[model samples]
Target chain A: MPPTEDPDAISKTPPEPPAPLAFDRPAFHQQAAPEFACALCGAGLTGQYYQANGAPVCSDCRWKAEHESGPPQAGRVGRFGKAALYGLGAAAAGTLVYFLVLWGTGYEIGLIAILVGWMVGKAVFSGSGGVGGRAYQLLAMGLTYVSICASYAPMVVQGLREAQAAETTAGAGAPEGADAAQGSSSVTRSGSTESFVRMAPNGEPDSQPLTQEEMQAALPLPDDPEQMQPGQTYKVDLASSEEELSPALSLVVFTVVVAVIALAAPFLGGLENIFGLFIIAFGLFEAWKHAARPAILFEGPFSAGAAEATRAPALPEAAEAHGE
Target chain B: MASSADVRSPAPGASHCPACGCESPAARLLCPRCGALLHRRRLEELAAQATQAEAADRWGEAAGLWREALALLPPGSQQHQDVGRRAAEAARKAPASLLDQPPGGAGKMPKILGSLGAVGVALWKLKFVAVFLLTKAKFLLLGLSKGGTLLTMLLSFGVYWAAFGWWFAAGLVISIYIHEMGHVAALRRLGVKASAPMFVPGLGAVIRLREAPADSLEDAEVGLAGPIWGLGAAAACWAVFLATGSGAWGAIAKLGAWINLFNLLPFWQLDGARGFRALDRQQRWLAAAFVVCAFVLSGEGMLLLIAAVGAWNAWRSDATTPNWRILATYLGLIAALSWLAVRVVPMPT
Candidate 1:
């Protein structure tokens, strides 16, 4: 049987009671005995008594109640651990959403990075049960940065794949031309260096000008694909584009470079446009503002005795009954 | 009837009856004959509960409790006077029902409707929009008569002339004046006293409110009105650009959109911060989602800041009941302005 159809269950689940009024409880109707006593400490009330939460309390007891409770407990490490977990989850979700939008639309909207920051900040705040401090704020900011960097991973990978495909196509179509282009460029570079060295000494006191034969020898040799040796490896020049690395090594190097670029994307993207940079700063400020510790002001220990002094003067019989 | 003396005093260890001279035993706290309180415990309890309610921001409840406490205290006593003052303060802080209830019948549209029913509702909404625009136009016209407004407008136009050409400067000044006039219009509608619009050379225009808004919702409406009018000015420029094929007008339109969108960033004394004050957690999230959608569609980077701020606001502990009308107006402004801002066009050489 469905729980909804059960009469007993329905009866057991009582309706929500309305919020209670201040004096909703039945009125107290017992008179104080001739012997005066403090409600909290059971001590005799002779001169003065204080009221706390409506009961007559002795001075010592009232003081203890007001001062004994210390400041609110600090947020424990376990709470921060929970906050970290939630922040990571939110970061992952934000990255996925950002990537999907970029891939689907073919436009990189930098605004989504702001949304990622907002999500991570909110998640951390919630996971810590709304306990916000310097640590939680730092955690939120770090997670937000990671989310934004992670979002660029897919785009970077796709770009690398496209570039590699284009290179492979070019490498397959004209192997001899490619090799000759490389060889001629290197030869021309070396010929220029040698000429510079020979020209430097021509005006020197002990050196004579070069002959036509020497000049002819200085000119770069014409490239011939047949002159290239099989399976010969060329030293990779860091500055020249003609030098190539092995496929595996190149892949590793490209991955590292792409990772750096991805990590710096948020900052780099902002630097391109002033408005983008301002908006990114505003987004980060929002996350920081949301994760700051909340300030609560508490009003002071008001004097109840002052009001007591202004009460209507008691009659002789009332004074005697109240022991005032 | 018992005399005043009898009401004030009774035999020792006996409860005094305020209505009659009957004396109950010492153990009895209430008058057996009249049921009047014989002890101050009940009054104290009410006072304590009232304090608790005030701390929780349940002002209405606190007011009620304070009133009850006031009734139990002896007249002309300091405690009675204090409770009475507290009750008044609590009543003042209580949320007004005016904001809780949606204005007009627009919010009462039937959820399920036929084709004709839908058309009827749309027509009704259109009528409301027309009336709103006409009212704002009336206020704008009235604002032009102010001597201070015209003098300051000329001053701002002159200041801008050196940076931008005369024609562009004039357009910019007019756009800002219209934006300031929007606040004047909303203030007049709400019956709030305010000064005429005054333009600052570099800092845009402003109007001094002689009276504060009655509630957060009213404050939000007044705050958002400026941007709403600014959006209209931008759209008008865009239309001119489309008609005349003028790069200058397109630039003006884009700048107008950008300025209004910037004002929507929810922080400090900006318009957007005031607008978000009335929204609860759910409504704030809804506004954030709307901003995200607008950003996606238009690819405007400014909306991201608004979205981020909206999300932050959603996590805040303090919130009032949601106002759908404010939400609709806020989201609509963001979407229209974002779309206008992204309409790329050449700047006139």
Candidate 2:
């Protein structure tokens, strides 16, 4: 049998948008919500299943709470994990930039790269950290950033420099006026032993002589051409013996060593950098922990959390849906 | 009648109200925590975030947060209206102005172009990974980025280089932190809620704010906050430079002056940008033009003139800025002072 609709029932029915529950009341009927409060901090739950009831509470609480649960846990050395990650990232970025400078604008400028590193550090971290003051922390970070760049950049720069020098040596030869078209010195090697090679400004035999030992060290005896480091000065002496011979560079690998030295300095000043890194990790960790710990505003706090935790397993059949 | 009702009712949502523990008969609830009418959790969601203000140094994030927080407030409430007004004020203010920018704004165009370039990079990375896996799975080296920057085995060069890095890094860290602390000082004076500066990996520190200020007072103070530290640091650095009789002092002084000057720019990310936006718009455009031109022209005049035109487009953007024009104007005066100081620094050999 078709049941006739009750006109009064339909008409009397309201057409309001469904009301959201007043947060003052409890969420579930009677039986306390399953683990509605955080077990560790006793912070009340929000949403479904175990989240702080609108307050931030989590491992940070855990960090604070670590005092009670036994001996304070010392953090692991992290196998230098965080440092390695950040350092690598910085190095790669620096290297790319160094290469870009060379490739793009031929900006072989060094300090600008250093400045850029500081700028990058400023952009990334906004200059905070360290024991003494904000500037010190910025210095540390800037150094870290610049050093990272120093670490990766020289390799490419060194490689390019070596490549360019190699090309010059390879193209050293042309006859007569062609070689002297510009004031360039042309070097010729001796047979077998590469003993007593000569370098004349325009291919004259009367030239500077490099001792056999110096020749072996700077030049690969009979095969490899001599390589020069950047920022090095080598003087080819015409009558130079092994004892007297001095190359354009007094020392090999000067720029590379200097950069490495700069990068390594931050580690020695203090252990503050490590602590600063921990802060970074902790901050990031807090951001992650936010999902679990809802930002709950404090209003005495106990009535909300304590009730949910302690009042569970009690019976209130008539008052099933209501709670403070 | 109002008194009796109030006495029995115990003001709703009042943090001190005893009746707050009881069930509410009304459909709308009041927040015992904040003494606010509990419309929905979403409204206060921004303040709920710990890092929104913490990472305010992030230009994009800081602006986004202020805007988002403004949107969340109920439009008509006093506080809501306040936020709306401030946000509207910020909007009315010019961020960094492009008017003074050198004609073509070489720097900004490069930056914009550079930002667009990241897309190509992402695509290339995807292609590289795909091809690597498809061609030779064994050759694919994932997690290589986690490896060291060749730190373990010190090359003869690396050992010396590390020492150099140690000194400079220490000095720079000190300078950077000191600069940031000045910001903290200003913020604390203004009674803004801010966390101690957190260290960023391979970067600098940032203080977090809990919420946007209802008025521009706090914002202006906060905006002005950072430069004081920078100036102090520069002064100190220069002092050291002088005491040591090192030529580097000139460079350091110049840098400090420049940092102060550049920060005064009326842009969103830079401190100057914040200051300029805090004031009214008329000054914002003027200050922006001044900054862009001064910076570009001072550093690379020819390039700046060309870049100024490009910067004009960024200046022309009428989007809402959080700061006002007064900050920019004041900052300009400071910049002029610093510029004079920097100009006096002897050129390095």
Q: How many angstroms is residue B253 displaced in model 2 relative to the true structure, after the best TM-score fit?
A: 2.9
**Clash counts for the predictions, in order:** 2, 98
Between which residue pairs do clashes occur in model 1? A29-B29, A30-B29
The DockQ assigned to candidate 2 is 0.01
Top model number, TM-score:
1
The TM-scores, one per candidate, come to 0.41, 0.36
Candidate 1 residue lDDT tens string, B1-349: 0000101111234433333333344444433223344445667788788888999999878877776665565444334445666766676677653322234645654555335686877876776678666655665777779999999888777767755668888888888888887777666555556899998665577788765554577678899999998998999899999999999999999889888887887765778988888788789888999899998888777677678777987887367589898888888899888888898898686
Q: At residue B186, give the lDDT of candidate 2.
A: 53
True-contact fraction for model 1? 0.01
Q: Which tens-of-lDDT digit does each residue in B1-349 have in candidate 2?
A: 0000101111223222122232222222332222334434443554334134334433333334445655444333334543444333443342432222333333222344446687855654565456544432221121112222112112212332343344444454444455566665554443345665544433344566765654554466567667765775677667777787665565656565554544544444556555544555454555546645554445523223223432553466564543444545454446553554445555544
Note the DockQ of each predicted structure: 0.02, 0.01
Candidate 1 off by > 4 Å:
A1-77, A96-115, A151-256, A269-271, A304-324, B1-181, B188-224, B239-244, B251-349
